[model samples]
Target: MNRQNKISPFLIIVACGLVLLYLHGCTRVRPLPGPAKPPTKAPAKKTEKPRPYKVMGKWYQPLPHARGFKQKGIASWYGKKFHGRKTSNGEIYNMYGVTAAHKTLPLGTYVRVRNLKNNKKIDVRINDRGPFVRGRIIDLSYGAAKKMGIVGAGTAPVEVTALGRPMAGKSAAATVPAYMPVDFYSGNFTIQVGAFSNPDNAEKLKRKLSRIYKNAHVVNDLHEKTAPFKVRVGACSTLDQAAKYETRLIQNGFPDAFIIAE
Candidate 1:
């Protein structure tokens, strides 16, 4: 009719170009499915808290007041050279456990050790700190100094009397104390490397161990109101010259030195 009206406009322009290529393949833009992968965050769990620690230039400080803490002095033992190691609260040192070591008590605090020259009592637990030398005050754990006979007098004249917290799964020798009353005190000899509730940090570790220790003093414990200064370093008159300056202050780093007959 005009060629069938030009073939009806070329079949209506090929059905409007196949409906615009099927509406451009249903509005194709398919690049939006690549942003849904962000869910991975879980790693945070560490809580250990129990601070304050320094060994040779001394800084201690770990006492949440282990109730009724008593004391007398001089008692030492620590077999097999610190047996299976790792103590001072991280346990593991089982020199035949009954455990003990207290520069400022409170690791587990369970003392009773009364070998005041043979009244022999035993029940230890403290866990570790030391007899950093200076009138020694408890360290035993070669099986509590061989059950308080003081392992053949390596040192004894004990008395430490704090029996505060320890019951669950008992057996610090079941809190032994059938009888324990012996008290005597006589002191001389020093090497205590540090103790302080800040007397200028015990005179800044008694002026840095009095420049290589000759007598680095600082003693002042009018009965501690929290660590009462102390810091001593020498004055050995014997106890084998304070055990040869506590084995040269524990080979010069003072791994908790010893020999404090004062």
Candidate 2:
């Protein structure tokens, strides 16, 4: 019995040792992995383009003294091509006259034009719109260019200076009244409204005010750097009407609305 007991204990120990070896073989251990890396990318490049030349957007600021403002550029002339045509201001154009075309200066605005090639200068009134194309600065009437010696040159470099008032010796100064304020009427009473841009906006405002006031209308106000369609609401025939509308406009917005008599 003693011998059997000893053998049994030995066999049991051998079986446990085999079981431990089997467990160690079956439970495999994977090697610890290193951290993964992120992806790399390439950089990109940029390209640029060239711009065109233009002058319409440049000379668009109001001058302190119309006489003080001056500019240099190519000048040309027009004749029978534009004769008898209605100007932007509704005035008839007489190409033989000494009137001049400016990009934006007010109609009736007088400017001193100098032909750089001949050194001859003449004062001309801005009576029409033009030099509508690019590269040219001023467009003079047939007689204006002839007097300034630009007709012979075809196109000449010139300097233009605003005269504030009227041309001293031009026909516009002699025949056409200088600085005549446009008449605005409120019934029998007349008031002048300043210029505005966006004629449709003016028309819209005109209709809105017309519903409330009798003398509402739109007027063309032309000036250098600005051509506006102004909405004149109500022709106040009396100070009372003007005063009443002025108060109403202030209450309805447009706190700056007022009346200027002609």
Q: Could you tell me every candidate's TM-score relative to the true structure?
A: 0.25, 0.42
- The CA lDDT of each predicted structure is 0.70, 0.66
Query: Tens-digit lDDT track for model 2 on 1-262?
Result: 4555355788999999999999998997977888776666566654221111124543221111233456799999998877998976688888878888876565667777988888998888787767866788899999898888778777899998776554345444365445332222222333323346678877787777778767888877453247457566666565446667766776877654645442
User: Which candidate tops lDDT?
Assistant: 1
- Candidate 1 has what TM-score? 0.25
Clashing pairs in 2: 104-224, 105-224, 106-224, 186-235, 196-228
Q: Mind giving the per-residue lDDT tens digits that candidate 1 earns over 110-175?
A: 667888776978676677888788788777888878877768768977777776765556554453
Ten-residue stretch with the least lDDT total in model 1? 178-187
Model 2 residue runs over 4 Å out of place are: 1-67, 167-262
lDDT of residue 238 for candidate 2: 54
Among the numbered candidates, top TM-score falls to 2
Q: For candidate 1, what is the lDDT? A: 0.70
Worst 10 contiguous positions by lDDT, candidate 2: 58-67
